[model samples]
Target: MRLRLRQFRLRTGPHEHRVVQPGQPLRHTSLRAPEPIGTLLGDHDGLNRLAGLFSFAAYSRHTIVHVPLRDSVPPDEGVGELVDLVLAHHTLGLRPSRWPALRRNLVGGTPLTVRTDEARTDRDSTSWRERHERTDGRGDLRHATHARTFFLFGNRDVFASAAMSLALAAGWGPRQKGVVKGHSAFMTALPTLVQPPGGGHPLELLVCFKPYPPYAHFRRPGRRGERRSAPS
Candidate 1:
């Protein structure tokens, strides 16, 4: 099995849990387990994203056993120790083993229901009521909406194969979004795969870098020695 590790900053909403609201935009940072098992099957990136999003920081730090399944058992379960290490480093007070619930819910065959609410006040449930009363029913009323439901797969290969199959069955068009960025190793391997004797798969990877906006402007010289407007 081959492994791929990655990191990303995910943008989320203010009401979203699992994020620390420090007077800034909500973002999630994570370190995923190596995807050796996922690489063979093909949906490495998809699977990694799924795990990163659902795998809460608290539980994974404790219960995740990194040893190969074939290895002999250690005298003492090290999950608790691993959890402690994570807490000490990140200062996030979360139990490491609590993640099995999330994993089970995702991997289980049954359909799962995810709930979200716009106005939730745990400390004072009447906060919303008071606000609504003060505004005389003209205040912004937010309702809980059901977002997309993701059918969980055990590994990356299955996810990729399913996606490719779906894309082939459903004709590609404007609604379909292509890959934006890929790891350097994956980018290098792509050229060889696209060489002669290989059919070019109807797929594309669009790499978009953030554009730097002009902070200041200056009058510079042109090639013809004329004054030109430039950004500094």
Candidate 2:
């Protein structure tokens, strides 16, 4: 599918999240894993704005993106182009895996519900330590919101996660928002390290979309394209 790319500025709130820069390696927070790089894109009253929420939730001044409606295209071709877009923009260090499952989800119309708030709740639970050690050990967990659940990517699966998020934003079907306090695999894996040309936001890219429900929250606000601060 053909896509239109646009550039915009976005700012982060006060949180200790990493930002992507040009010619730098993808750095981890410690020996464990890297913090998720949050990105948001949508349109408001005929004006499209791509903003960053950082670690928490804030919109100030930096750089982000907004993918306007994508051209109608077949699923396989669309996925291929998006994968190329992501890889062309950043070096993800992808492994040899064919990403069969990721392609399946995109082509077969699998429903994905990301509970972005689950990590926090899991951290505060009394049995947190036991659960962390027993499971992925990263405090990132996924459970079915209903019966029609599918696989969720974590454990440094940045390439697949990034592709999935881009596909969802660009018209991949059956995307919905749920709550999970745990860390976000997709957000953490988002490609946000490159510096835009001509001196602008630290990281910026052009994406394409078809008005999916996942980003509907950004379409209308108290004011059009108003600057919003990160949440405390």
Candidate 3:
């Protein structure tokens, strides 16, 4: 079935001044500075609208005009650029725990709708509502404005690893890239992407952890998500 839809991609990078890797696992530093520092990676305009993307089938359902990624994650076919952004963010040091939100923030019973009120919904959050308002909350984010919207079609782990595997396949890694391993656990735990629980299909990845603080360089990827480059 052919469906007319707008594609919106949510790809952003660490700011030039920020260090991409965390030297140590964040100690819940303070609500003001959350561990993964989601916002530190900077904002993308299409964030809100991504929640509304739909599959071709949804186009037939009148009540819903757009399909959401979590509903049915897309196959990682031609999403290399988006995947590279994921790898780079990890390479630069965003933690695995925080990566999911890079695409979706359904965590903590967060409401699906934006909080129209100006006040922060939760003091401890740089939430969807908060970010929407901070960035002027335009609900009309669409493909006309951004092209990378296609990446939002899956939950973080599967989507990220599918992309990461491509990097692994290309021989890009901490060892060859010479970049510090940001999702250190990814290197060891997932050492290589493999067929998941269902097996016999495209491989999936395991969860990655953040490095502990105090910053000791890992001798290799196996040490732990225990040491990394922290933002300066």
Candidate 4:
């Protein structure tokens, strides 16, 4: 199941040049440049193939695979093919005996498929206007339904909470080792990797958010006024 996957370190922005020359004056600015967040290891060729299979604009970058993190309303035609590709090349951290059930659930809309196309509807229609006019606690109907899916090793909620705690640590640098909390389940339906792909480091935490922007920052609102919390 182990494979040679490309490892990419996720950073918030472009690398800053700190070296100053002899005659150059020290330029000071309030703008904080991007910093490395974590590492992501994935199959380069497989990711390209997966992107080609989908009709939507899909690409892989530092922290995210630019594809829909969930299945769409009408269902994407390439979901089966994408799942097959993933199962063939990557390990879902499931045991040999659990493949059947896991495979079944995955194909049955398990939130793992990388579907990206948004549900199509008449943009200028009356129903669309009515639907968007309503508001939820976070925002109006225009607001996207935001949720997080945590990939954990043992007890789901416990590890999820632990992962969130670590993510909230703004001071965690690239060299800092992250911890995966909770006792091992031995073998279960949950996906838990002992080591991440290329780095072979202990897989501590991975959080997937549906309908996220291509970039890492989440402080700003969407074009349509949808608000998402900024990562600390």
Candidate 1 regions off by >4 Å?
1-30, 33-109, 118-232
Clashes of each: 6, 17, 20, 2
For model 1, residues 1-232, the per-residue Cα lDDT tens digits are 1222222122224321132111111111111111110111112232222222222221222222111111112112111111101111122232334323322332212222222121221212233334544654332211111111111211222222222322222222211232112111121100011112345442221111111122122122122654534635
Predicted candidate 2 versus true structure: per-residue lDDT over 36-98, tens digit per residue: 212222222111111111211111112111111222122221211211111211222222242
Model 4 lDDT tens row, 1-232: 1111222232224531111011211111001101111111112222222222221211111111122222322211111111111111111132334333333322212122333221221121223234433522111101011121112122212222222222222212211222112111111111233332377333322221112222243322223655545646
lDDT of the candidates, in the order given? 0.21, 0.24, 0.24, 0.22
Model 4 residue 32 CA deviation (Å) reads 29
For model 2, the local distance difference test gives 0.24
Model 1 reaches what TM-score against the true structure?
Answer: 0.15
The TM-scores, one per candidate, come to 0.15, 0.21, 0.18, 0.20
Please report, as a residue range, the 10-residue window in candidate 2 with the lowest summed lDDT: 24-33
In model 1, pairs of residues that clash are 2-36, 41-157, 42-157, 43-156, 43-157, 59-96
Which stretch of 10 consecutive residues in model 1 shows the poorest summed lDDT?
80-89
The ten-residue window of minimal lDDT in model 3 covers 36-45
